[model samples]
Target: MKILVPLKRVADPDNANKVKVNAGKIETTGLEWKPNPFDEYAVETALRLTENGANPKARLGEVVVVTFGPKETESTLRQALATGADKAIRIDATDDQLDGDVVARALKALVEKEKPDVVLAGKQAVDGDSNQVGQLLAEYLGWPQATFAGSIKSEDDKSLLVGREVDGGTINVRVGLPAVVSVDLRIVAPTSVSSKHSPAHKYPEGVRFAALMAIMAAKKKPLTEMKLADLVSDAALKITYTGFELPPARKAGIKVASVPELVEKLKSEAKVL
Candidate 1:
């Protein structure tokens, strides 16, 4: 199985408190960059699917990571490579040139060229939170898709059994090969990705840390660069960022001396009752 995973770089989610709104856009200066958390789960899913149990260093198939961004984004791809992806591809494009639709179109082009058996990506990127690219890419390719997959297993060489997260409970479905899957948080669980060599084998929860050796080896891994314009043209963005504003701050809470006073405050000042 040749699996393709899309990686994205986003401002560190942990430092969300530091993010600020500027005149009409988000101010990201001095903020750290890291792979989208959900996308990291996608990468871990792909790596687990291709891992060979008999030999830790050997893989049954390839896991290729792709991303669309400027030169700096290559660091993100390198991180995925360090985690065991076979190779990396960076689509040269600026942040201004990319939106959900443009990204979907570019990925569609890569899908056609690579002919991967499966395309796994995050359910959404934290930065935009659009949650549209994977479905759009599947539509653009005329391929089946399973979104918000919590658990996944190869039903056979040509199909996958996916456990999807819904409102009330999980729904299991079988999707054919050459499909697209957008993963959610549970996908990073130890036993989420089934292994062919050992059906019961479990990976450690969360994305694996790249060892010093692996980090050094990643430098030797093949990373191919492609021009976004060459792959897909007419990528006119369908949406534009008009402006940004911080949500209204919360008011301070008041303390009440007793239940009656609290009820009076609720019915009068608060007016809830």
Candidate 2:
């Protein structure tokens, strides 16, 4: 089983306060970048699916990680290699040039070349939260898709039983090979993923950390760079940002004199009643 996982780097979500709107665009200057958290979980999910938890170093299958960004994003791919991914691909492009549709188009091209049995992705990227790529890729490739996967059990190399979390309760779907799966946070839980190679094993609670030796080795692993134009003939963006603005500041609370005043405030000021 060969699995492809797409990763992305985003501004540190913790420092969202630093985000500024200048003119009609969000500023990206001097902001710290970290791997999108949900994408990292997807990477973790792929690793678990490809190896036995007891013998993680001896992979039963191949795991490839890919990303789209400038040269600096190579660091993100390297980090994934340090985790356990066997190879990495960095699509050379800037954030301004790509959106959900463009990404799906490019990935479809790459998928043709790589021919992996499965594509695993995060349900959404932290930066945009679009949650469109996986479904779009599946549609473009004419493959079955399962989103928000909380658990995955490999029925074999050819099929998967996926558990998804929806509004009211959980739903399970079985998808054949060559499918796309978008995973949710709980997908990283200890028992959330299992494969035929790792039957009846309870993995540790979360993604595994690389040892110092493995980190050093990751620097030497293969990371290929590909031109975005080479993958897709037309790299047009369907979504455009017209303007950006900071959300309105919260107002301080005030004590009302009586129940009537509270009711009046709700009716007139709050506008709920």
**For model 2, how does the per-residue alpha-carbon lDDT over 84-108 read when each residue is reduced to its tens digit?**
9999999999988999999999999
Residue pairs in candidate 1 whose N, alpha carbon or C atoms collide under 3 angstroms = none
lDDT of each: 0.89, 0.93
> Model 1, 152-257: lDDT tens per residue?
9976547889999989999999999899999999998878878575467767778888999999999999999999997787979899989987888889898889
C-alpha TM-scores of all predictions: 0.93, 0.92
Q: Which TM-score value belongs to model 1?
A: 0.93
Q: Which regions of candidate 1 fall more than 4 Å away from where they truly are?
A: 254-273
C-alpha lDDT (0 to 100) for residue 151 of candidate 2? 97
CA deviation > 4 Å runs, candidate 2: 254-273
In angstroms, how far off is 103's CA in candidate 1? 0.6
The top-ranked prediction according to TM-score is 1
Of candidate 2, the 10-residue stretch with the lowest lDDT total is 199-208
